[model samples]
Target: MTGNAALTTPESTAPQSPPEEPSVTVSGSPGETRRRAGALLALARFETRELLFQVQILLFFALDLVYVVLQMTLQEGMDDYPVLNQVDRATQPEPLLFAIAVLVCVNAAVLRSRKHGTTQQFDVLAMEPWRRTVAHVLSVVPYAALTALLVAAEYLWEALKPGAIGHGSLGELAIAPLTIMLAGIAGVLLARLVPSGFAPLVFVIAFYMAMVVASDAAAEGKWWGWLSPLVFPAYFPGDPVPADLLGRPAGWHAVYLLGLCAVLACVALLRSGGRTRAVKVVTAVALATTAAGVVGQLPHDKAALEAARRAASETPEKVQSCTEYDGSKYCSFPEWSGVRDDWSAVVDRVQSLAGGKAATTALTVRQRIDTSGGVEADTYIEPATTPGQVTVGTRWGGNRVPEFAVGVATVLVTGTEKSVLQDMCDARMVTIMWLVLGNDPSPAKTFQNVRLDDSTEGSGLLLTPTDGIGMTANQSTVVNELLERPHAEVAARVKEHWTELTSAATTTAQAARLLGVEQPKEAEKCGE
Candidate 1:
């Protein structure tokens, strides 16, 4: 009776273990897994929206637009210099802006929870740490996409503009987005590895400096230059990149960048979450694979590039497609035969100036297509009694007045003595200008359209006394006086003693004397 009574009493009621806490299983079912995934996606979308509306991002867009407009303006200003335009477009503002945006946005996203002291709260949730890291990284995708779209739009606008030469290929278009994504991944990994808030910015700035060094090295054709994603070959006004340089190497460069991005991503993933043995092993294997990919993408030896250029320059099979005029054989690549007529006309005019003396020289003229898609004229003259063998190639585009003048000057000066006197050079330049414009004294008709300008001080002083050469004001006065005479008279005087006049030893005053023109008493001060 006493034991039964005690059992019924509260104190004796079997000190019951606290109601078995109902086995709160934190492990989730499939539905819970799906819900967490949905939640992560929602979080990513929210973060992306926040990034898109940030004041910095909006300013970046405005600056990008300004850059494009500036580029367009500069393009118009440099229309005569195609190489400058290509270089300007290649190094445009898009790449720098994209990189900066990725670094800023990704760093902010990865550090958001920590900045707000919410990391521990997030850790208590059913979601894994690695999954959260991935969501934050994925949030950068829209920004990268937006950057790519902006780049594409700029390129499209450039292509649509009148006289616009497209800058890069379809493959190059991928470089911007790929580089941005790589920056984001790198930012995330840096955030995980470094405790300081400014770690990512420091790393990005350091990387930019490294890229500048790599770019300089790449210009020297070093293999390590390829390590920098921003290093790309620039095509100048008349120098185009070779087809080989643009082909397989481009693909390899893209792969190299992508592999770097993959490596950073895998390292970030391993460092963020559980760090399970399997994750470590997988990360190790991935690191090795990507490292190999990067090593394989290094550029081949510089000799390979030289060999390719040699191959491209070898003489073609169809040497018979040549035009002959005035003892000169003008031949071009079969595809470029259409330009022969224009070249022949210029040659005819030069021959007329020589008065049949040029016909005695055996000249072989060949047209070469430079890497920049411009035509170049290579002229070779066989050794003769007048001069030794002569070979000259045009520096700029072919068949233009400057090129023609250069060709004629090469013939005129080849057999003559060489001198570097300012007056002599000025005299020869004036003679060449006369030949280029015939009897026309119009400045616009001359090579490069060089002209004399009056100074702003209204002192009756002229600017550019001798143009690019050392043409003194006195020499310019003599040239103008000579041009005002009868065309036949001037041509006769020039042709009579062409050898003496073209000789570099002949000074401008001497030439003027020979042409029966009186020199000015004093030289006019240039830009007075």
Candidate 2:
């Protein structure tokens, strides 16, 4: 009896580990939370691996990579001198292919259990359906990360080049990865909402059509355009405005994309039965953040931009930095200092073939960009009314080189771009074209590039980088014949007949005969 009593005593009892605390799972306990997190991470890793193996995902990623490489290496123009700020946007379109792949793949991944008739089976697992939805959303992160790496690599490809100029924006750089995230999250949300196998295809087509329509407004910098995930800026490649003049709200736009991604993720979780207080709070916060970002990205006062533009155009000296290269004053935007040498080389070549007062005249090569009508607007840039000054555009190399060469010759032949703009249809055109093309290795090609029409003996418009001049048929005939002669011999004759050749009253026949070139019968049929 004493032994049984002692065994029955509470302290002396086996204690049985207090019945294991009834094996209760306290809701939101630390250990339980950690276990759920671990399960989520594991499931996400599995999904990411599955996505990596998809043929469509791999194919589109390869295509994006190839497109980026080709644009970097094979595209025409003076890409060696890339504007660093704009280089970040170069990869914006590249990720469209990869993002669509993610969209299709992530959508299929979310719908896999349904398609396989295993949705009920997955419900028996420790992780809830909302957690599974969260996992699906997390799975897209790795692909987004890969896209970020690709964008960074492309940017470095341009930034590392020896001639890259200007400063790149981190805000601008964030666009591609955020775009990928937006696409991937959108896929998960779509699958949860629609649950149809064809939903992704229909979604893609509809989304594409909407973006195509919104692109025109986006390209025009409309406020509503920022509603789109990818906004096309109002500037062309290799023709960017100064960093301060860009006026793009890239920082706010990045914030907008982040908010959009969060909103999509929360809605997807809610659709999958995540109706807890925490998720609801997150959803509210994300919506507010998105609204704030949208408000921040709206177009601001244009008065300041217009005032700045007028200052840049009317009195460029105040805004430009001056550098002396080879006896010429090159006034350009601060970022354009590196390109001054290239401009100076063209100027020296044009001036080398000139005679009389033109040969020794010092020139001012001012860089001009017209952002008044918008960065992408092909607005007419007025010729420099200032004497001894010539206009050079933000573009250089290829046809731009010879066109700029024409501007230099016009400034040399006449006092200012004003004189050339006044329809200088005289014998002076013969002398001007010679000065422009005499030293060119391919004079005929340069001539064709500088003119609107390809005809060798007809009236045509001569192109300049900033403006144009009219060329009479007689003037065209004389200039074309002179190009066929040895450059040195023609240059000597030009110097000997400089006065008559430059005079407004000199006839085309007199100019041609004096230069010892055959007078085309077409010269006699011209008006003056």
Candidate 3:
């Protein structure tokens, strides 16, 4: 019985079997994976809704919307036709105000658990700290997407305008949205590292100050300035270089920004105790990408670019194409080919007022810009030295049309821009002013439009995009009086005394008398 019991013990009675394994459940089973994914989705949705409800975030984004609308409707700059290449860059920084809101709010959201002493509450949750951190980072995506749409709308508003010129850059348009993403992720990273409410404020101040200093350096043409998230070259109004002349490494900058955002994200994940192999690999790749972009943007073949710029500026005739419109020649860069018709219309209107050789004289309206000092320079294009050649700029429409009309009239009256720059303290100034304003439907409005200051009766500088002429107070009064008369009547008098009126030696009183307008009693007479 003892022998039988040894052989047939209870454990071995049924069957010979291996030691029973502990109840092992596979960690990456399909059900567990599904549950994890569902949890992540739920967490991301919750965080996004939370951010959307934040009053400060909604307020700033609303401000952004209102600002964009105002820019399109009430702004004078928008009324002036845009140079597409520069317009994209010009609109890039516009979303930064909204970005600041996202940064601060997102940082606060990430630190909310720690601040409220609910850090332990997440221990029972299905999602880990890193996953929760990822959800917060992702929550910023909707705001970034919204900002992208705003930027697109702003760009399209300008690009679709009748006289928009040049080509827009896709690389440039990508910047604002990427910038939003970067800001959001940066906020999460900052909170993870510092866990302090004041961290966002400190970061914002330091970041803004750095950008200010970097912008100044960029204006000075330092290559290191490309390292900044946004590089705004000192833009002077109405100065736009051709698309090819910009030479901005916008593509690389966009890549750099994207990589930086990824690096920040992965670092945040690592800080949240994710130490995963995948996260480590992504961080390494992101760093490599950022470094490559930096190297790519460090200014290439600058000497060649400068040479090309000089050629485009000093001798545009070689690079420009000529178009014949109604007996006048309009020469412009490749981008302004469509704009020649608009220029021709202004020339036709101005030349129609001339009496002798000034009338029907074929003019060469050469589009010019100074790129030697680069686009950042506040370049004043001096008067064109070529006779019978009037100067026009890349910008058109709005006040630009009338300014161009003034240029055409000056060239027609003085025979060259060189003579227009000479001492014009003479009756010829009255005739030139009459030619510019008399044909306009609103003479006084046109007069105000062409001056630096909107003064109708003062010794002020009369402006054109390319150059300006000074007008005496007496000359202004005479021109104003002539404009008040019937167009047919004044036009006849101007035609009759065309020769004497345009003569530099002619006195203001004699020219005013010829035009049948009262002479000013003020001592500020023409030719003084």
- RMSD of each candidate relative to the true structure: 8.7, 4.3, 3.2
lDDT per model vs. reference: 0.57, 0.83, 0.84
- Tens digit per residue, CA lDDT, model 2, 91-201: 787789889999999999999989999988986787888988898899999888988898898899888977777778888889899999999999999999999979889
lDDT of 1 by residue, 377-490 (tens): 122222222241222222223223344444444454443212212233435644654565553345333433333342111122111111123345555666667766777877
Candidate 3 lDDT at 194 equals 91
Provide the lowest-lDDT 10-residue window in model 3. 519-528
The 10-residue segment of model 1 with minimum total lDDT is 458-467
Model 3 accuracy (lDDT, Cα) = 0.84
Q: Assess candidate 2 and give its TM-score to the true structure.
A: 0.86
In model 3, where do residues sit more than 4 Å from their true spots? 1-25, 77-80, 236-238, 521-528
Residue 397 C-alpha lDDT in model 1: 34
At residue 147, what lDDT does model 1 achieve?
Answer: 64
On the 0 to 100 scale, the lDDT of residue 305 in model 3 is 75
Per-residue lDDT, model 3, residue 229, is 88
Distance (Å) between predicted and true CA of 65, model 2?
2.0
**TM-scores of all models?**
0.65, 0.86, 0.92
Error of 1 at 29 (Å): 9.1
Backbone clashes for every candidate come to 3, 0, 1
